[model samples]
Target: MLIKSLPSTWDVEITQAVNGKEALDAYRAGKADVMFLDLTMPVMDGYEVLENIQKEGLNSFVIVVSADIQPLAQERVKKLGAMAFIKKPVNPDLIESALKQYGIAL
Candidate 1:
């Protein structure tokens, strides 16, 4: 739904993953420039994905978009190399801020 809400001019592409493994597969396949990850995904979690990405040296930027707002979780994701963390119920300002910080202007 948030993807659809983004402006068409942004020319953003999206890929769907039922779980973190698929997300990792897609990342390995060079399918994205930046990824928005949910920490509580099934099959594998975001932390696992982050670990795999770091291990494989994939060059995609990651932004965590999860309901898990715990300080430990945020710090862990940051340590794992996520570019930013955005909480759930994401607002436009936050989204824009993240994108702009990454140099992805809409």
Candidate 2:
């Protein structure tokens, strides 16, 4: 539903993963340019995914989108190298801003 709401002008690709492990596997398979990650996902979670990505030196921008708005969680994701931290029920403007920060335009 969210992907459908994105502007058509944006040249983007969408891939769905049921959990972090699948996300990581897709990442390894060259399935994405930028990733929107949910921090509380089952079967590995976002932080573990970020760590694995970093350890493998994957070159992709990751933005953490989660309901966990705790400051410590935000800081932890930042330390793990997430490019942005967006709370759940995300606003389009915030998504736009995050894309712009990474020099991606719609």
Candidate 3:
């Protein structure tokens, strides 16, 4: 549902993943440019994914979408290389604003 809310003008391919591990696999397959990650997931959480990305030095913009809105969680993701953090349930307007703020264009 959140994926459908993204603007058509963004003109990007969307790769859906059911778990953090699958997300990482997709990233490794070159399907991730801007990743919308959920911190809670099975088979590897978003934090672990972020850690792996950092450890592997993968170059991809990550925007964490999570229900855990605590300041510490936000700060942790930033330290792990997430470019932005969006609280869930996601607001499409905020997503667009974040993209613009980061100068991401398709």
- In the predicted model 2, the residue pairs found to clash are none
CA lDDT for candidate 2 = 0.87
- Candidate 3: worst 10 consecutive residues by lDDT? 1-10
Steric clashes per prediction: 0, 0, 0
Order the candidates by lDDT, highest first.
Answer: 3, 2, 1
Runs of candidate 1 exceeding 4 Å displacement: 5-8
lDDT score for residue 8 of model 3: 66
Q: Model 3: runs farther than 4 Å from truth?
A: none
- Candidates in order have lDDT scores of 0.87, 0.87, 0.92
* Shift in Å, residue 30, candidate 2: 0.7
RMSD from true fold, candidate 2: 1.3
RMSD of each: 1.4, 1.3, 1.0
Per-residue lDDT tens digits for candidate 1, residues 1-106, read 5575454567777998989999999998989888889999889999999999999888969988889989999999999999998888877678778888878877
lDDT of 3 at 54: 96
C-alpha lDDT of residue 83 in model 2:
94
Candidate 2 residues 1-106, lDDT tens each?
A: 5565455688877999989999999999999888888988899899999999999999968988889989999999999999999887878778887787778877
TM-score of each: 0.92, 0.92, 0.95
- Residue pairs with colliding backbones in model 3 are none
Question: If both were scored by TM-score, which would come out higher, candidate 2 or candidate 3?
Answer: 3
Please name the candidate that would achieve the greatest lDDT relative to the true structure: 3
